[model samples]
Target: MTSQGHVNNVIYNRLAESGRVNWTRNLAQFSDPKYQQEWFDLMSPKSIGLILASIRTDFKFPMTFPDRVTVLHKLVTKPDYSSDRFYLEAVMYSEQQRRPAAKCFEDIVVYDYRAAKKAPLKPFMVDELQATYDLQEQRKEEAEKKVAELQTFVQQVEDSAGAA
Candidate 1:
């Protein structure tokens, strides 16, 4: 049973390695602070909505709020990111955008929690994080190998137990 956190970590690493986290290409336009804020605001609603929609059930959203907050905090604090101010504003804008649907989307706390933890972002820091991810992937492979070996040993033990 893979936990959701593990799955998300894997997805994030894959995206980073593949250069899918290409913040530079889109964010290059944000050389100006004003433009950066606009871009952040635009991306915020879509990002939040997409994240919310990704929840498997309505209940999971509340349960994951803490983790969401942590990620947002990282986003805001990480010096690698370029447009922290805009990201914060964008998250605020997204919260406002959903005001009309407050009744249906009662879990606005999740968004608020996330926004409050907003860390400055490192647009296109994928290359910077690549080594870190490579180490993680290496560790994952080693763990898998160990698990496979353990499984083989367990099966052998079980087979001997049955034979005896």
Candidate 2:
């Protein structure tokens, strides 16, 4: 769901649009051929049910259309084995202001459409998600290492200049 604004309704719509786009893009990565076919198979099933259990949104800034914005989404929790639920957090950043315009948290459930009930998330699904999270963490560490190396190089150059 979206929070409403007094000026225009576009912001609410934009939030929903951005959230869907982010979810779709992130989930689509698992469909690549290199990933296990199980992930793709689970996602391709027509009977697989997805439901939004809840959405909490906080609007920190007012946004209007015609302005550029960036939306970021991250999985906040792994799927609960017992409950078959997962959580996702999302943020909308205002490009012009360089600050977050809104933040949202969503609770989602996996349902078995054929049985008409909630179902446990398959083990393969959980594994694939964990792998994705690990990849992201690895990239973050690599970037931090590069930054630290650059900082060390700069410090050495400064110290040599002082000794000269």
lDDT of 1 at 75: 25
lDDT of 1 by residue, 44-79 (tens): 453221122221111122221122211110121213
How many steric clashes does model 1 contain? 9
lDDT values, one for every candidate:
0.33, 0.67
Top lDDT prediction, candidate number: 2
Estimated TM-score for each candidate:
0.30, 0.65
Candidate 1: regions farther than 4 A off: 1-124
**Candidate 2: global Cα-lDDT?**
0.67
Model 2 pairs in collision: none
For residue 124, model 2's alpha carbon misses the true position, in angstroms, by: 2.8
Model 2 TM-score, 2 decimals: 0.65
